[model samples]
Target: MICDQLNDGYDLVEPQAPAMLESLRAFGYNIQTAIADLIDNSISAGAKNVWLLFYWDGSESYVSIMDDGKGMTEEELVNAMRLGSRNPLDEREPNDLGRFGLGLKTASFSQCRRLTVCTKTVNQNSVTRRWDLDYVSQTREWRLLRSAALNSEDRLSCLDKVQSGTVVLWEGMDRLVGETKTDDSKTHKRFLEIIEDVENHLAMVFHRFLGRKNNLQIWINDRLVKPWDPFLTNEKATQWLPEENLYFREDKVVIQPYVLPHHSKVDQLTYEQAAGANGWNAQQGFYVYRNQRMLVAGDWLGLGLQRDEHCKLARIQVDLPNSMDSDWSIDVKKSRARPPAFLREDFKRIAKLTRGRATDIYRYRGKVIARKSSASYLFTWLKKVKHGKVFYVINPDHPLVKEALNIPIEYREVIKALLRLIEETVPVQQIWLDSAESLDKQSQPFEGEPSREMIEVMSQVYKALIKSGLSIIEARKRLTTMEPFQYFEELVNRLGE
Candidate 1:
């Protein structure tokens, strides 16, 4: 038996230049995100320490990142300079820093036209590769150039004397320099300012790693980067949720919920740390981090359910193990992350409870003053009934009180005097009787009879007390116990005579 043979033909297509690299300069991708991508590559290269050095001449400036990592061979260095060469699905060492290979090339090209990567292995001679935008534009090709034997000395002279490491230099920053300014002095000042801004960005992006004793140390110029933790440390303020452990196959995910301190407990430093770094802005819910890297910095799937006024004070930190990356759908930029459908429900449940607690605290604060004032008045009234030493209530001056009322505490004297007048001249009974007459609008009334209008007025006065902050049940009990209505009935009989 003869088997039928099938022939498959392949067609060739012309090579095209990548638009992403060119678009970087055109679109002004020199912001924080692009800079962060550059650092991420350095960290992934097994660098235990990285230094970002900026040199600003009157009108020209360059930025360099030097790291002490496992340097690559001449062949490896060439591949490293190529764009999109690293496969995301390729298995890497457990401690490898990068999965996507586009980070270094794209990140560097986004900032400058010239990207020079120089490396030296522990026992091997150093090698260098250069990717020049001008060269690419002229040749219409992405070419990686290695140093020749004669140029090796010259190339090695430009690099630092590190035993085993790599240095990434970004030069010919025409886009960054922009059009010539008025004078060299003005241009130099602007250059310095840009460097400082870049330093701030790096400090925040690598804050967790920089702060760790075992993790890498990153420095800008000569200044050591300090980590800024979003969670404020206040002894008075803490929200600890029960520790929750969820298992997915062999992976263990820990969900620890935290309630931030009350607004009053947070100082300026604490408030800024919480509000600025932690994304504590309204509706800015949970912050999720993977491998100590912030993936989803704020909110859960944009639910918008956490927009309560008190929730502005809430922040929950969710720690996800690296194994959960597939479950989280972490993006290449690391700017957005999402939990799997199954895990989202659990997160939403925790978020709801945390936000509810914050709202309760906010509501309690709103009523605190009224409740305290009423309690003081009740205490004073009780003292009078017992015929004990007359105790005066002293109002404490507090910010909460100031926010609630515009009047000064000195007005307390005038308010007390008015209360005394009502207590002596009107009496609870007479006031009720007068209110009854006004409500009925009757001229020819029975001379000595108790009227239904008087009873209604007394009921209304009790409601007013309840509305003033007392519980309705409590106000009713107080009104009956005081016998204010009974006293008003007696006054009506006397007035008729």
Candidate 2:
């Protein structure tokens, strides 16, 4: 509290512990995020391995996170359990992931009613502290217990195995598991699912830490959590755009844009895995990180750009230091971030370039048409801008269209009028709505079904090319370069046959 000139005039007001703890639970932390907040503290303590244990006894279910980091002493554990323990404005160590110092308390309270932290340091006796919300509510005081809850000492046995470490145990998980039977299988499945959610969320949020060879290891019930890299960097098909660096008040912000491989380039399993937990479309946008920990994943950052299917491949990585927390409006939850005005301008430019490149790769089969061959990429519907308004027309020079035009001159006008009618009523608005609403539902040319229809269409195009004074080899080559057919290499090979 800042001192006033008339300090004696201020009231001796303090918040009620029960009400304050309840309010702290409303920090918008889900189980996964709250757990990640705790892991941030463990990482700050230089933990190489963090173990999470979930014990299921229905209503008595609890979650424990133990880290092999430098543990806190009795004094440190007491202060760490206090609400708003450290000032957010204080200078922290370079790799510290904490701000406001409320994570250890707030994150625990968000998931459970009883928050117990047992810690040990090298050559020092172990210390335990408990903050039972029920006790605090009944007592109506800031009573921080110096001992663990009765019979809960065994849960902190992992601390005994390590010379120095911290074990944060959460009991009375009212938010996660409410009053229920101890032997209910249905609820047990839900408990397992919650554990899975924690695993996946941790895998993504701390992917940078978990990705390295021997960096950080997070285990849930002895099952190791692997990093889920949004940018599939190992795949040769993924396009890594030029990295750009921006600075705000002399603080470095590195930006790297990645356009993931098209679905055709990779196998089905790899493609599905790369889609991420939210699928491909929802997982497309700027992934913001602070201190190598992901803060915001797959957001456009209010750059006025909608998540379009063509731009689904564009995912930009923006890394920032904790010093820019205020500049980015980083929340205590660490789940959201907004760019400063200066950085927003730069983000807009980069988004446009990345989105444009992604659109090209998405539409053009991820191949540079000019460099690939002499044949230009085909667009079934060509955009023409004659007047101020824009419109699309079918390319009449296409082989199929040309073949129809070579029908009798008498029926040529009929074909022309039919083409005009089809072009005029192209369902542009409907197509946009379908693509925007359900991108996966929208089918490409002969998408799911067998390629019998495709082969038949290719045969017609092949015959037309042959009729236009082209040899069998030339006609087959022409079909290979055509749209839709280019993707079917085997079908293109058997075009003339």
TM-score of each: 0.66, 0.76
lDDT of each: 0.61, 0.86
| Tens digit of per-residue lDDT, candidate 2, span 360-459 | 7855765544327546666667766443344789998898899989978889999999999998998866764355445446577877554777778878
- Residue 329 of model 1 has an lDDT of 74
Q: How does candidate 1 score on lDDT?
A: 0.61
Residue pairs in collision within model 1? 429-488
Q: Candidate 2 — which pairs collide?
A: none
Once fitted onto the true fold, the runs of candidate 1 whose alpha carbons sit more than 4 angstroms away are 1-8, 18-20, 23-30, 147-161, 181-197, 233-236, 277-279, 304-308, 369-497
Candidate 2 residue 329 C-alpha distance from true site, Å = 0.6
TM-score: model 2 vs. ground truth:
0.76
lDDT of candidate 1 at residue 468, scale 0 to 100: 58
